[model samples]
Target: MRFSRVVEASGAVAATRSRTRKTAELGGLLDDATAEEIPTVVAWLSGVIPQGRLGVGWRSLTSLTPTPSESPSLTVAGVDDLFVRLAAAGGPGSVALRQGLLTELFGSATESEQDFLRRLMTGELRQGALAGVMVDAIAKASGQPLDLVRRAHMLTGSLPETASLAVHGGAQALAGVGLQVGRAVAPMLATPADSLADAVAALGPDLVVDFKLDGARIQVHRRDDEIAVYTRSLRDITAAVPDLVEVVRGLPCRTVILDGETLTLDADGRPRPFQDTMSRFGSSGELADDPNGLLRPFFFDCLHLDGIDLIDRPLSERLAALTTVAPGMRIPSVTNPTVAEAERHFDAALAAGHEGVMVKSLAGPYAAGRRGKAWQKVKPVHTIDLVVLGAEWGSGRRTGFLSNLHLGARDPDGGPPIMVGKTFKGLTDALLQWQTDEFGRHETHRDGHTVYLRPEIVVEIELDGVQRSSRYPGGVALRFARVVRYRPDKTVDEADTIDAIRALLP
Candidate 1:
């Protein structure tokens, strides 16, 4: 397939707001892709690179102004080959080599293709070809069940691989994909409930309510003596989290996959600030030197145990398995609680310096990678993590500071961040200075009053609610939004989606 075909499909997907139209366009593109070309095509359309980051930055892209070719001649394989070489170019003079390669590749493309390549390389491809849409597209192209494709995607945690399987091998191949004890599967997610009572009402009385700690999500995979720790995004941080590794290594079961949260706690046994936890979590050094910064793992769900896969099992059975293996490390929870009892549990979690409570149905299976109502979270305050889109200059007491922030919610369909609202509230003087210094590092452009930024910074915002409006692209506006704190622990991909914000409408 020609690279131009992909560029055209991406453009068509971006030009339409209707998800049906976008899925059709992507499915058509997939229908034209060869089996060998499926993986690369799927990854590109999903706004990611198969080779990961190539050390290319926005500055490098802006520095080159190559004159595009008159015709489209670049093949998909040829472009992928260039990316491979770019990823391999390193050591001395590697910068120049990479620039030369990028220039050569861009110079061989037409104007539209150059734009596509630039956006693709810079992680700015904001088409609507998200993982879910792509899964549907794969199902459409391969004539397979959507559930089979989605299940394969969840189990494998790789869209490109799932696409290839669905396209080449069909439903039989997809059905064969299962939970591997050593490999990390996508973690199950929870939906936000309006309140504890509402959550209990939705999931019924036969549910377990556990504390929702404000910490990083982790999946521990233990196969005999080998233990690996992975984040929610599936990045391996086994070396960085030795304490967690040791804890999992001590579990009774030899082959087990545990889903849990890891956080740094103070001497009084209260959870520390999220930033402190991430600071230690992201470090690759030996944490034994700092006793106060050690992370403690709190296992909540057992996905597999003793050579048995329990993802298809009920939550009650999984909890029973977890209790048998690591009862001391299990999160505090109460099973079959009434609405009032669940309310008390929610209060207790907040009192313990945690975020809120997670109400889970006892009979629901571990629906990995899907945020269904089987698990619901209820918090006392309404808070969301949004991306920093831009900021306006401040005046008066906050002179010279980038005070008023432009906040945006993630588009669940993988389009660009949708603007929901703006706020200068809840920012302290120290925070103002920090934003001024940090926003400068991520600046993409500047106008007379505001400095636009790349959507790289995630900020937790507390809002009273949301109101329907036409002022923003999301067709809603935030009500009394205030900055809670900057969430360095989160990426833009983890930010709250526009659909979530809209769900707050009264």
Candidate 2:
């Protein structure tokens, strides 16, 4: 198949707001694609490389100003082979070789193909139909059930591979996907509940309320003495923390898959700061400096044990297996707690320096990577009115409009406002139009994607908390921040200060 066909399909998919249309477009493309070309289409549509990140920078991409071909001739295999060469470029004089490949690839692509390839390489493909919509497309093209494809994709953590089996081998191929001991699957996610009462009322008496700790997540796969630990994003950290490898090896079972959170505890057996846990987990060299700061795992759910795959089993059965494996290390959870009892557990978790609590259903099997009613997280978020320092031009569906606001907290020292973070979430088309009109009048300067403003617009923002960071001028950044509303009545002087944000950091 020609690479230009995939580019045209992507544009057609992005030009609509209908999921049915997006799925139909992608399904049609997949129906016409060869088996060898399916994975390339999948990766290019996702704007990611088959081998993961290619380490290509924006400067290098813009430097190769080759004139594009007038007609489309690049095949899917041709592009994939070019990516192979790009990924292989490393060590001494790799710069020129990489640039040569980049120039060659662009020189053969048409003008439209060049734009598509550049955006795809730079990860600017904001087409509304990436992974989620592609999943539906694969199911449509394969004539398979959506749930079956979703399950297979979640289990494998790779849509291209899943699509290949679904397209060529059919349902029996998807059924072959099971919980592998050493392979990492996507972790189940939770939705947000309005309150404890709402969560209890939704999941009912048959629920498990577990302490939601603020730390990095780890999925441990054990096979005798060979153990592997993967992060929530599926990156293997088996070599980073040798202590964790030892802890998993100590488990009684010869083979098991455990899903849990990893945190650093202080000498008093209390959870340490989140920064401390990240420092240990994010390290690529030697372990943490302080021995007491080593990462500790608290098992919560078991997916595989004793040669049995418990992923299709209910949470009740999974928890039972988890208790048999790591009783002492399991997260503190309650079964069918009353409103009063649930509040007490919530208070106890906060008092113990943990986050809030997670309310989960008992009868449902684990829904990997799905944020449905089966699990709901009830974390307390802090809200504050912040000043908008700037806004960036949107892309794809949001093109020609201002999006991704630069948030700032008022400096208590009476200096200029300090930038804390940027967010483009929780925005509507009406809000985007209003922001573009209002902020364009206050434009002070323009730099690439960002347009600086006069720092007069006050907007209310909600966040999980602030984290220690050097990226922002305030020495901290907001985690999971989203715009709540425009504070039209509030002035810049009334906005929350940098000191207030720092106090929220743990």
Candidate 3:
């Protein structure tokens, strides 16, 4: 396929404010892709290279190149091999290579497409197309079912792997292999309910209510004495979170993967505001010298213990196993047999300065990367899950780092993510690394220091509140908003809706 096609698609996606329209355009492009060139097509459209978690702009840059470096020397087989190396390389070297690739592609692309590619490569594209749509595009290109692709990619945390499996073995093979591998799904997410009654009505009576801590989501993988800490996006932050590494080192389990949240607390021993924890690291300025702020881990669900994968195990079983292995690291468990008791726990968490509660279904298995009614969140107000559509360039203090994020909520019926507002808070060093690398990839266009992205990543956003807005779409605005963390498991389709925003009216 010509690099022009990919550049054109990027432009189309960016021009499209609606997720459905953007998805359809990309899906059409992928559908036209040849069987032998499916991988290349997917890579170009996603602006990613197969190895590791590739960035968007880097991929776009490479697409324009007449002949970018191919993985002919890769001795290791399968999709995981490429991504693992790429993700591990999380530094300037990998970033520079990607930028070069985009430059090459943009040069080869047509005049119109070049403009689009430039925007995408610079992280300025405001299109609502997200990875969820891209997953659909990948499935269409490979002639696989959407659900099949979603399940496979979600389980492995690598879309390239899913594409390879689809082409090599077909959708059935991907499904079969996924079932045989039997890994846990990512943690389930919640669709905000109008009230507790609505949530209960949606979930019925078989739910298990757990206290939701106002902190960062963490996935801890422990192998014997070796342990790795990953954010919900699957980005490795083991080094930035040395305290978590130390705690996991003492765990009795030989090989294990657990999911939980991390938070920083004030002198009062209360979980600090989500932003306080986020502000501890990831700044280009003098953040390293700040010794007062730190993050602490609070375990929730155990995905693996020793060699056995416990994702299929019930929540009750996983919690029991978690407690037995590391009681001190375990997040406080809320076992309320009644709704009133659960409400009390929610109030108590608020009183303690924590966010709210995460209600889990005791009988459900650990759904590794999917969000469902299995877990529901209840906050006292002032938070929402938003999609990052674009970002403004930083200046002075924020020169290199992202200054502010353009946020949006889910649009029902496959519409565009409605712009709510922008934020520049709730970031740590690890968070900063992830964003810079990620935003760099999504750069559609940049003015001075700002990069724009194709609203593909969904973030858990917290803000003071919403006010009427005439400057942006959706007729509303979010004030003092910032990212809590990136929501890798979620798709733009699953983001908070305008109706949910309307509910925030004071």
User: How many Å off is the CA of 264 in candidate 2?
Assistant: 1.4
Residue pairs clashing, model 2: none
- Per-residue alpha-carbon lDDT of candidate 1 for residues 1-506, written as tens digits (9 for 90 to 100): 99999999999999887889888999999899998998899999988899998989888998889898999999999999999999999999999999899889989999999998888888888888888888989899889999999999999999999998998889899999999987889888898887888889889878999999988899999999999998887888898888888888888877999999999888899998887887776686587565768999998999999899999999999999999999998899999998888888888998999999999999999999888789998888999999999999999999899999999999887778999999999989988999999899899999999999989899999999999999998999999999987877567888999988988899
lDDT of 2 by residue, 1-506 (tens): 99899989988877786878888999999989987788778877765678666657867886778888989999888988988889888999998888888989999999989988887786556465556788999998889888888888999988888898888888998888898899999888777687888999999889999999867788999999889998877778888878788888988999999999988899897898655675665578476678887888998899999899999898999999998999998999999899889889988889888878999889889888765688987866656779999999999999999999999998653345889999999788888998998887677689999899876788888888889999987899999999866754345655888988898789
* TM-scores for the candidates: 0.96, 0.78, 0.69
- What are the lDDT figures for the candidates, one per model? 0.90, 0.84, 0.65
Instruction: Compare candidates 1 and 3 on lDDT and give the better one.
Output: 1
lDDT of 3 by residue, 321-345 (tens): 8888878877665563466766777
Candidate ordering by TM-score (highest first): 1, 2, 3
Considering every candidate listed, which one attains the maximal lDDT? 1
Badly placed stretches (over 4 Å) of model 2 are: 382-506
| Higher-TM-score candidate of 1 and 2 | 1
How does model 3 score by TM-score? 0.69
Model 1 clashing residue pairs (backbone): none
Runs of candidate 3 with Cα error greater than 4 angstroms are 9-28, 31-36, 49-107, 125-129, 176-186, 197-206, 273-276, 279-294, 385-417, 421-472, 475-506
